[model samples]
Target: MDCTNSKSVLKKLSVALIMFMFLTLTQGYQISFADSVALTNSNTVTVEAHFTTEKIRDGFYTSLVVNYNILDRSNIKPGDKIIIKLPDVCRDIKPIYKTEHFSNCTVNGDTVTLTFGPNINEGVQGYFTLYMYGNSNIKNNQNYEATVTIGNKVVKANIEGVAVDGGDSYPDMYKVFGTNFPVNNLGEGIIVDRNKPVPYTIVVNRGRKNLGTMNLKDTIPNGMALDTSSLKIYEVSPNNNYTDVTNLYLNSGRVNMNYKHLQIYFDPGNMYMVDYNTFVTSTESKYNNTATMTDYYGNVQGQAVAILGSGAGAINVYKTVDKKNIGNFGNQNIIYHIKFDSFGTFLKGTMHIQDKINPKLTDIKVTGTNQFTVKYDSATKTLDAVNDKSTIEPGDNAEITINASMKNVKPGETITNTAQVNGGDTNTVHTTKNPLIQLSKVGIDNPNHLLSGAEFEVINADNNERVSNIVTEKGNTNILITSDKPIKFELPYGNYKLVEIKAPNGYALNTKPIDFSVNANSTIINLTAKDNPTGNIKIIKTNDLKEPLQGAKFNLVKDGKVIKTGETDKEGILEFNNIEVGDYKIVEVSAPKGYEISKDTSVKVNKDQTSLVNIVDKNILGNLNITKIGNDGAKLSGAEFTVEGPNGYKQVVTTDKAGVATLNNIPWGTYTVRETKAPIGYE
Candidate 1:
């Protein structure tokens, strides 16, 4: 009985040990599962983000929706939280305090923490609408991505279709959003002329959201001044149509202007449009204007920005010659006037003016008002002037005078001088003296018939010296005067003679010097040099016996075109008078009754000389006869033969009843005759 008791005790102790071991293993497994829950929580949750609007303007507020789902509730506990890291460009975040799934929501810098509620369940889904302001650092027209942390797992969410800087929005107008609608938004700015008003348009409540007691404020750019008289307001409809409500707003004192700042109050009704004008007061290149909308409590709702650009003002420089300063040969003491007019903006600081004086001008002197300091560099022929202290106001004019003497300049010679302000806006002026001469070379009897390729030398009659530096119209030493235009050149005020060095083709050269005079009284002197044409073609036709052969047809060809056609007279002589002097060809079209045509003769006619062409023709004739006979000397009547001659000439002949074949009118050359067909039977 004691042994049985010991066995029973041992079994009980073994059972007890087994239970303790099972408990230890179960506890260890529970602890391991609890530790792994944090790591596996990442796979139990899903996150996604997207922008509510298709595109959000850069540096503006936009709505971002972040959706999260709890896939496995066993891994997620009441105290667990999901942390969403917002993008860097998202600033001024306005997050919801609480949602259905999360009991508390808090933001710390760029992170948003959402704590799970006590009643968290499996497959629970919720979303947070975050109103984030995209800062200027955000790249335009690009998708944004953020990271979400759930336990030890990190998930990525992307907000696509978001753009900055008015991408896919109105041009130059950055549109910002409020909780429900758009607030103060201005259109793109434009450049206007100085003192001219620039128009501006602002649209409010474009989303048609109704909010009570809305207040709008606009701050004009520093360089612009508001025009109160041009302010107008209109009520807008959902379809984007407008109704003028300026009078009602003005009478009710809803619109107020405080210098460059403007304010308007509207009772919630419909969207509104505001129109106004501002004049640019400064010469700044760019101006940025901002407008904001707020509730009655002064909580800012939305903001918009408009940019203005003032185009560079035009600075015009005009240079003119003083008409009173004149001389016989050229302007001995020429005076030039340069005027500067500032069109749209004031010229400040040192306004530089440079005048490129003509090389022919000497002794340069420039004078201006007390504001200007002038200097002249004779070596470079440049005059420089500067306005250092005084400012040239817009639409105001500044003048400077330049005095110089002309050297080595002939009469009718024009000197062009150019001046510029600030190395741009170049202006030019020209001065000329009197007594211009235009020499024309024409036909002797017809003044309208001009000639070309005539060379001449001008000599000073008093000094008997050849004149140099003669300026011609074509800038060439050899004058080419055409029928439509005459050659003009400038000479000094004195007596001069033109000696013809070479005349045009077919025109006689005038050896005598053509005398002319240039004086201050006459502005232009027209002279004509007439040339006598030479072209007479005489053709003498004769026979081989050296006797005159009459009735010979001839053609005078020039450049392959027949100029004249005639037949020789009874004396075998043909003459063409008044023909153009050039190389020509005389071709005999047909010879007299019994003679053959002569070969073509080339001849050249000289100026004022007759060209003689003597052509002789031969009256020779050749005949060919063929007789066909049998072997016994009997006549064969039906024989046929082919005759070939010079110049690829060929003919066929047949024997007649007299047994004879003949070929006539063949040129003087060797010939070949072959029997093509024999009489009747003979081959």
Candidate 2:
């Protein structure tokens, strides 16, 4: 009786332990996990391919290769038979088929190689398949794994079944043959005792290198034939998102083929535009094609429209040692990239087994010009593409532009922009050298500092007088100096000398030489001046018709007024503006030969408006026959005097373009003529 009681307790304890073990396997992990599996098994496989039982328009199908190291325990060779079963739930998919080849398989004394399908690392039996309608994307659930008998021994393994509808609930490794879906929560290691090193099954790739820019492609290397154009791949890890690196949509089934017929590839889950180039190469001729064949079943060759990398996401990370991508694309038999830049990034998360149901989804962040930077964080294993600082100035406020792929974020998520000034105090200022400004100071300090609360007096350099002209325009300007102090002063707008300084009680003056500049705030007048007749003359109202006109009024004006004025006579002209050293009455006109005048025309006498005068011969005096005073020495040879009526003209007898005719119609009044116009070209 006691023995029976002890046995009952032991049974209870065993059951509880088993139950605890089951619970732990299912619930112990808060995150997803995975590992690379090495395939080196020479197991006989039963390949059964079919479509889902319940088909809408069409049905989908997939296959799996069951791997087992059973040769050591029993006798099973090529062509040997093994019986396996599927759950009654899935009747549509058949139960058995024939095994193809022991791919990458080896009976190296005891260990075998698993080189079947695209995945070559881990032990894989064969690819289970599904059949569906034309151009239809379908999948199946391998319902259950029933007991299978191999050489009189009942072996147990989860049956690779088929289910077309439950993609949302299960992993669909159907895209890549022999590949497993769902982040491989299981880790990788030798299942057998490592101490007893059985012949190594997976060949550690010893060749093929990464070209800085060169990538993995199959066609580059001749002698290799792969099917890349028509393939459907699955996103097994990282939530099975179907996309090439750079977000470019790609056929889920095709992995790129490269040199030596090696299988190299880019990631469907990385920044497609930035980092989607892939390649593969090898040294050994025999292993070259084999390695590629074992990695991916098909080859890739076609136009690549890799979309640009996501702005907010970090560079994609891949499972590459040296240069080869692990498991072709995944563990055992798969092809893909688990890549991202290690620098300037911050986050790490593994997503797996994304299918038509569960796909890869990520939210990326981008920033405005000079707004923020990115960094990596190891503890949080997730990329944090967030703004690190604000790029704004207090006085010159700015708007931060956030360029992110949140377009899918229908309603924008609340985000913050935190800017930081590395080394600065107060408001920022954009100096001459730097266009970007930071807050450093608010406003200027001192505006004006007067002497005893009185306006500063203006001084003229010409006469040292309290002048009004020198101190006009920009009469007063405000001056700000520093932080908390300000002063006022009324000053003029002119160049000044630092004579002295005066300040209020207890406040220090601007000790640095206080030479400041003011602006000219007064309005200025500009005059465009011209005269009807201008010429060289020495005296007013002299020469020509009358030597001196007694009562003619004239004034020289610049801008508005002249500092001097004079009179003209029958010559009907006057002079102004050009005042220079010369004769008593007038001066400054550079006279023609035989005509005495200064270089500058000063008092050119002429009609104020219009006048007339009687002409005399050149050697004759004005109304006085002054030439006869030379004892009749003059002959009037150069000028023979002539007179006309009020309408008849001389010299120029008719009017021309300017409507100015020669002197005519004297009417007994003093007449005028062309003043100092020498014969054309004589000057």
Candidate 3:
């Protein structure tokens, strides 16, 4: 047969067999003490047939039958016994064989034994059904076996089943009922709100046979209410198609609502089904729900459970600076606000707020919210906010305001503070005020043409030490002054010095520092720098012998350079004009006839200043020759004469064989001669 026809035939056979079994198992059984029977399938065994548990509750008496097909087996025995064995799943056991083929069954704790009767037919094909009281649910999937013995061979048939509704639930193909949002599927923790109803889609998948007339019931936990209008049911086809059946389902007064319970009926045959929507509200802190689907046979088919809880509220702490700018250093005000926003949920816990104040500030004074207990740590400069009352219910917004101060701050400096809410989120606020310093550099001669490219250094006026890293331009440690632009600095208000470290090309450096104070207001200092004017210098070359040396050469050296070279005139004077004002050296390069050059002399020229360099070049004199005569005027070779001159001059002369002695290159002054040693007879 084709697959389609084969499936259709199998389905028809399965339905017929399910109906027959359902009638046989549930027809005569009546639970007298209980209102209804909670019969769940205990075991199923068949040959060349499919079996399933359908419409049966747990912990109920059920019937199990073993069918034997004896067409092929012909042992040809009339007195042989057929024994049947039962598992531990059944209690209060009894056996029934209508054909008189088996009888006299007895049960042990976990074993059941059966014996064959004498009326057993030679060949038979039928069922031997066992009646037993049901126990509590099984722990897990377990096996139940029935056996028959023939000579030395044993034949057994087995059925596997599981416990249900007795502390055990496992994934099984026979069971149904699930949800779109399971607690495990929704992740850990119950994070939901009742005022805001959450949706959970309940689904009932297809089973082996048609489950007739199922009643869906929901038991809501305390502090919760369900929305009746949101009840919806959808018939899901085999192709996963949805057809809304809520109108038809609820039209027959199928809904039965109690205080916290709901029951609705749905006739879901062998097809997928679903309750599309339902909403619930929780009035308390948490909510729990359990829903079940049961058939008309009083058998639970599917179940779903969930738990949800309202989350905690959020905390926000905002801080702001009161003053736009802090003009002075001490005692500035800052405001803070702590808000506990419910965010549509209730909160009950301790609220914490801590503020780490700027170390530059001190003496924290709580100006607002005197109900809060304030603590300060001077070492860390922290302020803690602790409320006396800690509990906050749902929809409760508790707010606290605080005002504090900052100290020891200066102009052009920023003071910042931060505050945290619930020891988590933090916010920082700051205030700053700057002091200005303006420096104007100008030439003394021309104030309008201010000094450009004149670098000035800033120093501490108290110690006269240079300050670093404060500059108006890159690559410069000092502030450069321009003709039209004055140098300015934003600094903390205090005492500082502006000193001209490098002057313009020709201007003189101002060595004196401009001492100034930066107070609340801005200050401007107009510094004046001067450039030296040209001056004249005259060099007078006079001989010590009271004569002017006309041919004397003079060199005027300025900064180690010969600036002017000139010879003295007839008056023994040389003059240079328009010489820059600075230190200059004048030297006689050459001397006149019979005159010696003088030493170099240094002179400093000031603005429009004239200075004279009186260099005296002495005139060289010729040697005086003297003769020591004997009686024959013979040369006195051994004569020594010492010549003494004016102005602390002295010399010595010797005589050769011609008896001559002379003194050379002496000054033109009167002198006396004396012979310390005389020749043989001359003195």
Could you say which candidate leads in TM-score? 3
Please give the range of 10 consecutive residues that has the lowest summed lDDT in model 1: 13-22
lDDT of each: 0.62, 0.24, 0.51
In terms of TM-score, which candidate is stronger, 2 or 3? 3
When 1 and 2 are scored with TM-score, the better candidate is 1
Model 1 spans > 4 angstroms off: 1-188, 192-199, 203-215, 222-225, 234-245, 258-261, 267-273, 279-283, 292-319, 324-333, 338-353, 356-382, 385-400, 404-683
lDDT of 2 by residue, 17-50 (tens): 1111111113232111111122322332222212
Top lDDT model: 1
Clashing pairs in 1: 58-164, 58-165, 534-608
Query: 279-363, model 1: which lDDT tens digit per residue?
Result: 6665443456667777533545333332221211223356778753254433368788877654222223336778888787778
Candidate 2 residue 254 Cα shift, in angstroms, is 22
Residues 189-221 of candidate 3 have per-residue lDDT tens digits of 122223334454455535424567766777655
Model 2 regions more than 4 Å off = 1-345, 348-572, 577-683
Ranking by TM-score: 3, 1, 2
What value does the lDDT take at residue 242 in candidate 3?
77
